[model samples]
Target: MDTMRERFVSTTSQLLDEDARLALVLAEISKDGFSAARRRHPDRVINVGIREQLLIGAGGGIALTGLRPIMHTFASFLVERPFEQVKLDFGHQGTGGVLVSAGASYDWPAGGFTHMAPGDVALLDTLDGWSVQVPGHPDEAEALLRQSAARDDRVYIRLSLQTNARAHASDGKPGFRTLREGRGGVVIAVGPMLDHVLAATEGLDVTVLYATTVRPFDSAALRAAAGVQNAADVVIVEPYLAGTSTAAASEALTDVPHRVLGLGVSRRELRRYGRMDEHLTAHGLDPRGLRARMARFLPGTPR
Candidate 1:
């Protein structure tokens, strides 16, 4: 099974072949993967060197010319580094393009904290009219990428090194998919956190909701799930910053009494450069850590 980034290169390359209106902009992040793509469509496949801002600027420029541009880069460089350009280039300009990001949170721990972007989604939340998709599997990533390419919308497809054991199919719509039903509260797992979440909540009577499309957050599904549960106690397990979607959850269940526990990467950075699994355990995202936390939050959960 190839990683999401590898699948992205192959899928986007095929997309370039299929769609004349589609263009890709990069900042030397995944240039090697797109070597053949560049050769095939030199005019469309752009590499703007190390300038992150220019990468977005170039994509936005292409969008103005009625071309659907897909900008690729590390999450930190793509969203955090060139945030101002992202805000102005795509949002302010009122143009549509796809921003595909890799190096999610701490995928490459050896690359140091500069490469991590746990707060990328939170930062984008401040902006308006951006559709965010966090695919847990390569197949989902390819599906979402192709879906985004077909439309001229301001879409952000977050690709991560972490993924679930299997892929969950979608109906080409944005919403959460309920994986398990229970009378106890609800657990919403986003992107790569599904498998861990499943393991953590095993034997616990709680509804498990899988979310790949976060923005335009499927409030209806959340409300519906909470409506039947014994308690509206919701826990959101994201692959990015903890509490990134807590506020959104609260808003979704504004009228109903509820409590939300957001879990993911901590704001307190781990000083030591360790393996990705080490980081997951440190952040309380592993199955053991998650079970402990979930047991405490949702009553009647077995310890």
Candidate 2:
């Protein structure tokens, strides 16, 4: 099974080839993989080499020059390490570009906190007019990339090693898609967390909503599924930081008072490193942990 990152490299290169107005920037991560594209579009495809700050700046500059740019690197380097550049170079300049990041949450457990970015999306939330897409599978990743590339808005596509076995995007359509139906409440799964969510809500009487796009939050669809009265208890399960979208959830349910339980990576960092499953288990994001925590919030879940 090829990872979402692999698919991004493959598809993005094709985008670089097809669209002369498209440019790519890399900060040394996966630079070897894009050698051919770099050769083909030497002026458009730039490798800044360990300068994360310059990476976004170059992309911003390229956008100003009337080209859609895609900048790539690890999540931490792409977001946290050079946040000022992202904020000013793009946001201040009013220049839009697509920031594609790999290494989801604690993707490289051995790489530890410095290499991890559980708060990447939350950080982007602070900025305005940015569209964030966290696709569950590779097919959805390609589709979302192509969609974002066609626009000039600030787009952040969070790629990960974590993936679902299948793509759940509604053809090429946008917004939330229902995976399972019930009235116990809605358990919204973000990106790679779909598999874990499906496992957690297996026999529960809750409507399971799967979404690849989280930035827009799809309030209209959410309200439609959960109802305006907000009688049903809501649960949001994401692959990134926990409770990152609680405010959005609350805002959407303004008409009715409802309860929301968010499941995701904890704020505390795990000092030791092992496998991805170990990190997930530590954060209570594994299926077993998810099932346990969600059962209490949902009620009547099979023990």
Give per-residue CA lDDT, model 1, range 189-245, as digits (tens): 998999999999888888999999999899999999999854599999999999999
Candidate 1 stretches with Cα past 4 Å from truth are 170-172
Which stretch of 10 consecutive residues in model 2 shows the poorest summed lDDT? 224-233
TM-score of each: 0.98, 0.97
> What lDDT score goes with residue 101 in model 1?
98
Local lDDT at 285 for model 2: 81
Top candidate, metric lDDT: 1
Give lDDT tens digits, candidate 2, residues 236-256.
Answer: 989999999888988898887
* Model 2 clashing residue pairs (backbone): none
Regions more than 4 Å wrong, model 2: 170-172, 228-230
